[model samples]
Target: MLHHLSIRNIVLIEALDLDFAPGLGVLTGETGAGKSILLDALGLILGMRADSGLVRAGEAAASVTASFEMGALAPDVAETLTDAGVEVEPGEPLIIRRQLKADGGSKAYINDAPVGVALLRELAPFLVEIHGQHDDRGLVNPRGHRALLDRYARVDSTAIEAAWKKWRLAEERLERQRAIIAKAAEDRDLLIAHLEELVALAPQPGEEEELAGERATMQKGERLAGDLSSVQQVFIGSDSPLAELRVAARRLDRIAGEHPLLEEVLAALDRAMIEADDAEDKLNRALDALAFDPLALDRVETRLFELRAAARKHACAVEDLPQKAADMRIALNAIEGGEAEVAALEQAAAEAGRVWRALAEAARAARTEAAGRLDAAVKGELAPLKLDAARFRTAVTPLEQGQWGAGGMDRVEFMIATNPGADFAPLAKIASGGELSRFILALKVALAEEGGAATMIFDEIDRGVGGAVAQAIGERLARLAGVGGGANGGQLLAVTHSPQVAARGTQHYFIAKSSDGIVTRTGVVQLDGAGRQEEIARMLSGAEITPEARAQADRLLEGV
Candidate 1:
C-alpha cells in the first residue's frame, strides 16, 4: 500500500508532502482547485511520461517520490528487482523517485539507487494501478486479457510452457535429421563410387613408404647386378682362388713328413685354404640376392602411383586412405539406415506435440470455466454502478493453430454490450469516458482478489452520476478497500466530487489553490472530522455551504 508521496516543483505543487493510509482515501475540491495536479505528481513517481512544462515556472526541475510498504512482494515484482540486482527485504518499503528537468530529460530511482525509467514502468503495475477515463492500460488493454484471465483462473502455466519447449526442441531435431538425410541421399551414388575405388585399390597403412623403399633397392640392384655376376663367376670356375689354395695345401702335405720345418709350412697352408673357401661362399650368396626381377620393380611402382593418385583425388595424405575408405563406408551405411531413424524421430516429435496439446487444452478449459465466473461477478457489479442494462462478458475464443502460444490456444478478452439488444464489443471501444471508468471499476471489484495492484487510484469514477448511483460507487470502493469486513482489502484512493463518495473515505484530503498575487501554488491537507464535514458541505451546496448541507454531511458520515 502507498504510505507517502512527496512532490516538488511540479506545476502548481511547488513543494508538498502527504502521508497516506490504508482503506478508501478520497481527495475532493472544487473543479479547478488542482486535484489533477496532485494526480499528475503521483503519475511521475509511477513512471508516466514527463513533461518539461510540469516543472514550476522558473524552476530548474521537478521530482516526485512515493513510498510503498510491501508486505509481500508479488512474484513478478520480486523477479524484476532481483534481475536488476536491487535487494529489498520483506516488510521493507519500496521507494521510487522520478526527476524531470525543464529540458525534457528525466531520471528514475528505486530506493535511492539509480534505475532506468523502463524498470520503474515495469514495477508500476504491481505497485499501483491508476484508472481514469483516458486510461488504456490495466483492465482496458486487450493484450493483457489472457494473463489476467489466467491469474483469475489460478492457472499454473509451468507445465504448459515446459511441454511447449520440449515439443519445439523435438521438432527442431526432426528438421535437422531430415536435412541430414536429404543431403546424404543426394550424395549416395557418388559415395558408393568413391568407396568402390578405395576398396579396389586396397591401400594399407605405410604401404606407400614400403613400396618406395623396395623400388629404390631394386633400382640400385639393377645397377650392380652385372658386376656382382662377374665376381660370382670368379668364385665358381676351376682356376678360382679356392681351387689354387687347395693345390698348394696338397703339395705342402706331401713334404711335411720329410722335414719338421716343412710340416709347420703345411699347417699354415691349410688354415689359408679354409679361410679362402668361406670367402668364396659368401660372394656367391651376395650375387644371388642382387638378382631381382625387373617386372617386380614395375609392379611396385604401379602400386605406389595408384595409392598417391587416390590420395590426391580424396584430398588426403597417402597414409590416410584406409581411414578415409572406412569413413565413406560409414556414410553409405547411414544413408541406407536413415529411414528408420527418421521414423523414430517423427514418432518422438508427434508424442511431444500430443503432450503439449493436452496441457494447453486443459488450461484452455480452465480459462473458459473461469471466464464464466468472472463474467457473472462483473455483471453483478454493473447495476450498482448505474450500468443495469449493460451486459458484461469474458470472451474466451479459440485461436488458430498458427497463433497458439505458451499460454494456450485461446484468446481472452472482456466484452460488453451497453444495451440489451446491442452486440458485444471490446470494453475500450464501446464505452464513453464515464461509462469506461465505471466499467473498469466493475471489473476491478470483480477481480480484486485475483491479481490487482496493491493500491488503486480511481480518477473521478463517480463523475456524471449522483444520489444512489454515486452512493453505490462509494460503497463498492469502500468494500474494495476492505472497509466494513469486505474481502480483498488493500488501498484505494479516489478523486471525487460527490459528497456521498467523499463521506465513504476512511481518510480524506482537501486540495486547494492559493495565489499570492505574483505566484500561485497548490497544497493538500489531510482532513479531520470537522474539515471533512466542511468539505463535503461545500461539495453539496456549491459556493455557499448552508447549515442543512453540514447536517446532511453529518448524515452521510453517519451512514458510512
Candidate 2:
C-alpha cells in the first residue's frame, strides 16, 4: 500500500506531504482544485515520465517521493529486498524518489539506490497503476484478453519451460556445429600453403646437426692436413731432415761393428723414419673422411633458411615445423569432411522445426478454447453494467507462411459491437467516452480474479456515470478489493467524482486549492468522521456546504 507522498517545486504544488492508508481511498475537490495535479505528482513519484514544464515557474527542478508500506507487500518482493541487503522494518515502508530538472533530465531511486528508467518501469507495474480517460481499458486490450484467457484455461506454463529447454539446446548445437564448419573452411586455404612449403623444404629431422658435425670434421681434417704438409715440407726443405737422417744412418751402419754407440744411433734414425711413415698413413686416413662440398653447405643454408622463414610465418620456432605441418594436414581433412556434416545439421534443424510445430499446435488449441470462453464471459459481465446492447469479443486468427512467432503463429485482438446495428469494430474505434469507461469496468469485473495484477488503478472510472450507475461501479470496485479470497491480496485505487463512490472509501482524501495571489497550490488530506462527511457533502453539493447534503453524505457513508 502507498503510505505517503511528498512533492516539492512541482507545478502548483510548492511543497506538500500527504499520508495514505490501505483499502479504498478517494480524493474530492471542485473543478481546477488540482485533483489531477496531485495524481500527476504521485504518478511522477511512481516512475511516470518527467516533463520540464512540471517544475514550479521559478524553480530549477522538481522532486517527488512516494513511500510504500511494505509490511503488506507480496512475499516474493519482500524476500528479494531482504536478500539484496535492504533492511526492512516489516511495519515500516519502501521509499521511492523521482527527480526532474528543468533541462528535462530525470532521475529515480529505489530504496535510495540509483536505478535506470527501465527498472523504474518494471517497479511501476508492481506498485501503483494509473488509469486515465486515455489509458488501459484492460479486457478491451488484446494483451489483457490474453491474460484473462490464460487464467481461465490455466495455460500449461510448464509447456513453455519444456519447449524453451528444447529450443535452447537445439540452437546451441546448431551454433557449435556452425563454428566448427567455419573453422574448417578457414583451415582449407591455410593447409595447402603449409603443405607446399613443407614439401619444398624437405629437410630430414636432425639433418642440420649432421651437416654441422660433418663440417666440423672437415675443419679438423684441414688442421691435420696442415700438420702433415708441414712434416712433408720440413722433410723436403733445402737442408732436408730426411737427408740428414739417411747420412747419419749410413755412417752408423759403416761404423756399427766398430762401436756399439754408433749402432744405437742407426737404430734411432730408422725409428724416426718409421714414425714419419706412420704419421703419413694416419694423415691419409683422416683426409679420406674430410670431403667438404660447398654445394652441401649451400643445401644446408637453404633448408635452414626456409625452415626459419616458415617458423616465423606460422609464429613458431624452426624445430616445430614438422609438427605444425602435420596439424595443418589434419585441419585440411576436416574441411574436406564438412559438407557431409552440414547436410546432417540441416536435417536436424528441419526436425527441430517439425517438433516445434507439433507443440505449437497444442498451444494454439488451448488458446482458442480460452479465447472463446473469455469472449462469452466478458459479454455476460457487460450486460448487467448497462452494456446489454453491446457485445465483447476475442478475435484469434492464423497467419500466412512468414508470420510465425513465439506467441503461437496467430494474432489476438479485442473487438466490440457498441450498438445492436453497429458492425463489430476494434474497441478503440467504436466506443464512446461513457461506453468506453463502462466497457473497461465490465471487463475488469469479469477478469478480476484472472491473471491480471495484484492492484488496479482507475482514474476517473466514474466518467459518464452517476446516481445508481455510479453506485454500481463503486460496488464492483469494492468487490474487486475486498473479495481477494482471504489472502490473495488484490487491491484497487479508483480516482472518482461521485458521492456514492467517495462514500465507499476505507480511507478518504480531500484535494483542494490553497493559494496566494503569487502562487496557486494543491493540498491533500486523509479525511475521517465529520471531515469525511463534509468532503462527501461538498462532492454532492458542488461548491456549497449544505445541511441536506451532509445528511445524504451520512446515509451514503452509512451504506458503505
Candidate 3:
C-alpha cells in the first residue's frame, strides 16, 4: 500500500507531506480547491510525462516522492521488482521519486537509485491503480478482459502457454529442416559431379608441396651433372695430378733416411695423395647419380598445375581440398537424413498442437463458466447503484485460429445494454459518464481481490450522483478499502464532494487553496473529530456551516 507522498514546489502546492493508512481516505474540498493537483502530483510519481508548467512560480523544479510498504505485496509485485533489480527490504518502505525541472527535463529514482522513467512506469501498476472519469485501462479495457476473468476464476493458464511454446518450437525446427532439404536438392547434382572429380583425381595430403620440391631438385640436377663431370676430370681424368703426386712422394721416401727435412716433406705429400683419391671417388658417385628426366619433370609440373587450378576453383588452399570433400559428403548425408528427420519433427509438432488445444479448450470452458457467474454478480450490484434496468454480460467468444494466442482461443469482452430492447455493445460505449462510474464501482467491488495493486485511487467516481446512490458508492469504496472488513486488504483513496462519501472514510483529508498577497498555495489537513464535522458541514452547505448541515454531518458519521 502507498505509505506516504511528499510534494514540493508543484503547481498550487508549495510544500506538502501526506502519510496514508490502509483504508478509504477521502479528500474533500470546494470546486477548484486544488483537489486535482494532488492527483497530478501523484501521477508524476507514477512516471507520467512531466511538464515544466507543474513547477512553482518561483522555484526552478518540482519533486514528488511516493513510498510504499511491500511486506504483504502480491507475488507479481515481488517478481516484477526483483526482475527489475529493485530490492524490496522486508519491513521497509520502497520509495519512488520524480523531479521535474523548469527546463522541461525530468529525472526518476527508485529507492534513491537512478533509473529510467520506463522502469518507474513498469513498477507503478503493482503499487496503485487509478480510475477516473476517462481512465478505463484496468477493468474496462477489452484486451485485459480475459486475464481479469482468469484471475477471478483462479485459472492457471501456464500449462496452455507452455504447450503453445513447445508447439511453436517444433514448427520452427520442421520449417528449418524443410528449408535445408530444399537447398540440398538444388545443389545435389553439382555436389555429386565435384565428388566424382575429386575421387578420380585422388589427391593425397601434402602432395602439392612434395611435387614442387621434387621438380626443384630435378631442375637443379640438369645444371649440376656437367659441373660434376668436370670435377671428376680434374681429380682423376686428363689432369694427371694424382700420378705426379705419387711419383714425387716415392722420390722423397727414398731420400728420407739421408735427410730428416726430406722425411717430413714426404709424409705431407703422402697425406695429400690420399685426400686426392677420396675426392675422385666422390666425383665419380656424383656423375653416376646426376641423371635428370624431362618427362618426369613435365609430369610433376602438370600435376602441380592441376592441384593449383582445383584450389582456385574451390576457393580454398590446396591442402584444404580433402576437408572440403569430406564436408560435401556430410551435406549429402544430411540430405538423405532430412526426409526422416522432417517426418519425426512433423509428428512432434502434431502432438504438441494436440496438447495445446486440450489445455486451451479447458481454459476456454473455465472462462465461459466464470463469465456467467461474473455477469450475474455484476448485475446484482447494478440495481443498488440505481441502474436496475441496465444489463451487464461477459462475452466470451471463440477467436479465429490466426488470432489465437498463448492466453487462450477466446476473446473476452464486457458488454452491456443500457436500456430495454437496446442492442448489447461495448460497456465503455453504452454507459453515460454517471453510468460508467457506477458500473466501474460495481465491477471493482466484484473484482476486489483479483488485481494485485494494493491501492486504488478514484478521482471523483461518485460525481453527479447523490442520495442513496452516492451513499452506495461510499459504502463500496469503504469496503474496497477494507475498513472494518479484514486485517490486510487494499487501500482506497477517493477525491469526492459527497458528504456521505466523505464521512464514510476511515481517514479524511481536506484540500484547500489559500492566497497570500502575491501567490497562491494548496494545502491538505487531516481533519480531526470537530474538524471532520465542520468540513462535512461545509460540504453539505455553501460557504457557511449551518446547524442543519452540522446535524446532517452527524447523521452521516453515525450511519458510517
Candidate 4:
C-alpha cells in the first residue's frame, strides 16, 4: 500500500507531501483545484510517461517519490526487482522515485538504486493499478484478458506452459535434424567421391616431411657422385706415388742397419706409403656410399608431389587427410542410418504435441467454466454500480491450432451489451467514459479476490453518477478497501466530487489552489473531522456551506 507521496516543482504543485493510511482514502476539491495535478504527480512514480510540460515554470525539474509498505512482495514483483539488481528486504517499504527534467529527460529509481524506466513500468502492475475513464491498461485492455481469467479461476498454468515449451523444443529439434539430413543427402555423392580419393591416396602423418628429406638427400648424392668418381679414378690409377714410396722405403731399410740416418728415412717413407693406401681404401668406400638408383630418386620425388597436391585439393595439411577420411566415412554411415533417426525424432515431436494438446484442452475447459462464474459475479456487481441495464459476459473463444500458445488455446475477453436487446461488444467500445469507469469498477469488485496490485487508484470513478449510485460506488470502494468483509484488504484511493463518496473515506485529503497575486501553487492537507465536514458541505452547496448542508454531511459521515 502507498504510505507517502512527495511531489516537487510539478505544475502547480511546487511542493507537497501527504501520508496515506489503509482503507479507502478520498482526494476531493473544487473543480480546477489541482486534483488532477496531484494524480499526475503520483503517475510519475507509477511509471507513466513523463511530460516536460508538467514541470513548474522556471523550475529545472519535477520529481515524485512514493513509499509503499510491501508487507509481502508478490513473487513476480520480487523477481523483477531482483533481476534489475534492486534489493528490497521483505516487508520493507519499496520506494519508487521519478525525476522529470524540463528538457524532456527523465530518470527512475527503485529503493534508491538507479534503474531503467522499463523496470519501473514492469513493476508498476504489481505495485499499483490506476483505473481511470481513459485507462488503456488493467481491465480495459483485452490483451491481458486471458491471464486475468486464469488468475480469477485460480488456474495454475505451470504444467501447460511447461508442456508447450517441451513440445516446441521437440519440434525445433526435429526441424534441425531434417535440415541436416536433407543437406547431407544433397552432398552424399560428393562425400563418397572424396572419401574414395582419400582412401586410395592413403596419406600418413610425417610421410611428407620424410619423403621430402629423402628426395633432397638423393638429389645431393646425384650431384656429388661424379666428383667422387673423379677422385676415385686418381686414387685407383695411382699416379705412382705409393709405389715409389714403397720402393724407397725398402732401399732405406736395407741401409738402416749401417746408419741411424738411413733408418729414420726408411721409417718416414714407410709412414707415407701406409697413409696413401688408407686414403685409397676410404675413397672407394665413399664412392660406394654415394651410389643410388636414379629411379629411387624419381619415386621419392613423385611421392612428395602427390602428398602436396592432395593437401592442396583438400585444403588441409597432408597430416589431416587421415582424419578427414574418417569423418567422411562417418557422414556416409549417418546417411545410411538417417531415416531411422528422423523417424525417432518425428515420433518424439508428435508425442510432445499430443501432451500439449491435452493440457491446452483442459485449460480451455477450465477457462470456460470460470468465465461462466465470472460473468455472473460481474453481473451481480453491475446493478449496484448504476449499470443495471448493462449485461456482462466473458467470452472464452477457442483459437486456431496455429495461433495456440503457452497460455493455452483460448482467447478470453470481457464483453458487455450495455442494453437488454443490444449485441455484446468489447467492454472498452461499448460504454461512455462514465459507463466505462463503472464497468471497470464492477469488474474489479468481482475480481477482488484475484491478486492484483497492492493499491488501486480510481480517478473520478464516480464521475457522472450521484445519489444512490454514487453512494453505492462509495460502498463498493470501501468494500474493495476491506472496510468490512471485502475480499482483498488492499488500499483504494479515489479522486471524487461526490460528498457521499468523500464521506466514505477512512482518510481524507483535500487539494486546494492558492494564488499570491502572480504565482499559483497547489497544496494538499489531510483533513480532520471538522475539515472533512466543511469540505463535504462545500461539495454539496457549491462554495457556500449552508447549515442544512453541514447537517447532511454529518448524516453522510454517520451513514458510512
Ranking by lDDT: 1, 4, 3, 2
Could you give the C-alpha RMSD of every candidate to the true structure, in order shown?
11.2, 10.8, 6.4, 7.2
lDDT of each: 0.89, 0.72, 0.85, 0.87
Question: How good is model 4 by TM-score?
Answer: 0.80
- Candidate 1 segments exceeding 4 Å error: 188-340
Give the candidate number with the greatest lDDT.
Answer: 1
Winner on TM-score (1 vs 2): 1
Which is the winner by lDDT between candidate 3 and candidate 4?
4
- Please write out the lDDT profile of model 1 over residues 264-332, one tens digit for every residue: 888888777677678778876765665578899999999999999999999999999999999888777
Clashes of each: 0, 0, 0, 0
| Model 4 agreement with the true structure over 351-415: per-residue lDDT tens digits | 99999999888888889999999899998999988889999999999899889999989899899
